[model samples]
Target: MDKSITVACVQAAPVFMDLEGTIDKTIDLIKEAASRGAELIAFPENWLPGYPWFLWLESPAALTPLVYQNSLVLGSEQAKRIASVAKENNIWLLLGLSERDHGTLYMVQWLISNTGETVGVRRKLKPSHVELTLFGESDGSSLKTFTTELGVIGALCCWEHIQPLTRYVMYAQHEQIHIGSWPSFSLYCDITAALSPEVNIALSGSYAVEGQCFVIAPCAIVSEQIIEQLCTDKIKRNLLKAGGGYARIFGPDGSELTTPLAENEEGLLLATLDPASITFAKAIADPVGHYSRPDVTSLLFNPAANRPLSIKAASFIELIYTKQIVLPGSEEVQAN
Candidate 1:
């Protein structure tokens, strides 16, 4: 891996509920980042079709069809086009989108290698609050990190960072670069302090300090157009606001690396990361390394994939046919 690398965190809004249009804009953004010498680019969570803020504003039943229509499916032409853009730009891409499988939608982060290979796909283990209305949950298989030329890259969507076990699992993988993908923080700013930008941005920096990794926190912006469309009445308008782009890049020691963009502006927050800084930070306190006392306490992790159906092996059928196995209720098994 190179000693130093430049990274970009996208703070732009998607072409709201339009997958193809958002993909086109994403391609252009990737090109712009590559031209500016970025080796890797990270986009905000649910950026492909934008976050379903309507779930909080109104009934999700009305928008369910639109969400399903815009959600991306793995290996589709749309997904390939995004990967191709990454390859063409010669940059590693971390894209957050609403992934569709069968009839369910999931909050997902896709990692694309510089060579255009789909390196990893991780779904958010659990959607937050109203998000559950539109998105499905993921299993332990979704919690993973990928080893790449840049480093061991890992990503989590929105509130996943707040999960102690999830963050520790990523730290155990020795993730050198972490992406904290978030939707706009423009929801109920005055109504609650928990969803404020300060709290979420602090969580991103805390992740860097705790894991001894570089953090690229890409957050989306709730544009005026989005607010107008989602907020139909005066009460709804009061619930949601525009301008929540608080994209930031932090060092391993929890120091802000890039200058923040305005809450309403759309642009990339660029920062050059040095691996040596991670080393220095880890030297002080590596949570999963020298600083940890696993004998006293440890995490119980189950990394197996959770499948809905379990099929009987063909070998089992062969054994029965050859009279090598007997039926439990029968005295003996014989081949006819």
Candidate 2:
């Protein structure tokens, strides 16, 4: 068999706040993708516990505080069950869990190996503006990619896509694959005047090419179920949305090698890859490499500073459990 591996990004929407429903749906999608020959898989941002969209889409005048108050706890028992599903299916999974750590909520990417082992985990460096009211993501720890059997993989949340420095870190790591987990695209958010849809496809595709790595961008595709839930809630149910649409795969050159799916049609896009593609591309113009001349200018990266900081994450967890330090804007405490 070829050393190349097959991967897919399963695009599906959780049943807005129905943790069991979201987890079950995600597991179902995983099994489906595996049946289609995907060995490694990924899902959109917070594929479990359903991403809360109404948190945006409204002004205090247009949105009711009561509606935004209720959101799914990403770290609850229902989500762990999804981990079991990943193990049982024997597919490496990159899952986005809207974390509820202690009383504080965070958006974390949880990576599970094919055997269902918790391989890597990272928190969103920061939530969208005003989202700080609903989440706790510190700028202290934002970027890194880890080695896997297939290749080096990294994760970054939505909007961060627009941040160049953030992309540089992953690219410098020589990541072979990157997962840009995003909530569904908002039709109402900023869009280009020229062929917006095409611009979007190009934008998403460029991340892969720009980083010189294959990108599995499985953005959330909201369902009518989610629309209905929001519609019914009257509070967060302000019923306005976008994205949660397509799941796409881009080649190293930032070309769409596989076709994307339709909105509301939950499914996956699988693509076979050779890690060598990254090596080949970087040969031409490695942003930080042979093509770069320090005589003109230099990009500095402190790998040493990064190595020691990882311990801070561990220490934070320990403090939360022992000191009972209350997280701002949170009602829950991280339990050891």
Candidate 3:
């Protein structure tokens, strides 16, 4: 792996509820980042068709159909197009999208290699607050990291960074590059400080310090066009203002690596990350390394996928022993 690499964090608005348009825009952004020599590009959480801000602004049922229609299925053509762009640009992509499987939607972070192959996909273990109305949950299996040519890379959506256990698990995996994907902080800006840009950006910075890894936190922007489309009344407009982007890149030492763009600005925040910096950060306090007190407490992680069905088939030997076997040229044997 190269000791230093350039990373890009996208801070722009999706073509709001338009999967095709968003995909086109995403391709352009990928090309732009690649032209500027970014090896890895990160997008904000739910960048596909934009975050379901309607879930917070209007009736959840109002946009449910549209959201479902625009959601990206794992193997769909839309997904293939995005992957192809990564391959064409010869860059690794950390794509955040609203993933659809069967009839359910999931907040997912998809990692695509420069070769256009999917490295891994992880869903949000638990949706925060109103998000539960639109998305489903993921199992422990989604909490994982992948070893890439760049380094040990991992990703988490929005509030997942706020989960202590989740951060610990990623840290334990020795993640050198972390993608903290987030939606716009424009929702309920006046009502709650919790959703403000400052608070959420702080969380991203804190994750870098705690995990001792570089954090590339990409964030979406809420445009006036998006506000006009979702906000039917003045009260709704006040609830979700325009320009909630606070994209940032933090070093392993919890220092801001890239200069932030304006809250309403739409651009890529680029920074050069050195793997050697991680060593300096880890020397003082490595939570999962020498600093952990395993005797008092420890984590139990189950990496198995939680499948809904399991089929049990009897072996030929077991069937014969039970006298319930039938051969191709022999008559069926019945139990005595």
lDDT of 2 by residue, 112-150 (tens): 888767777787876877666677764534577888887
- Candidate 1 or 2, higher lDDT? 1
lDDT of 1 by residue, 132-249 (tens): 9888889989888888889889999999988999999999999999999999898989899889999999999999999999999999999888987888999998889988999999
- Evaluate all candidate structures by whole-model CA lDDT and list the values in order: 0.92, 0.71, 0.92
* TM-score on alpha carbons, each prediction: 0.94, 0.78, 0.96
Model 2's lDDT to the true fold?
Answer: 0.71
Tell me the lDDT of model 1 at 129.
Answer: 92
In model 1, how large is the Cα lDDT of residue 166? 94
Pitting candidate 1 against candidate 3, the one with the higher TM-score is: 3
> In angstroms, what RMSD does candidate 1 have relative to the true structure?
3.8
lDDT of 3 by residue, 24-70 (tens): 99999999999999999999999998998988877788899999999
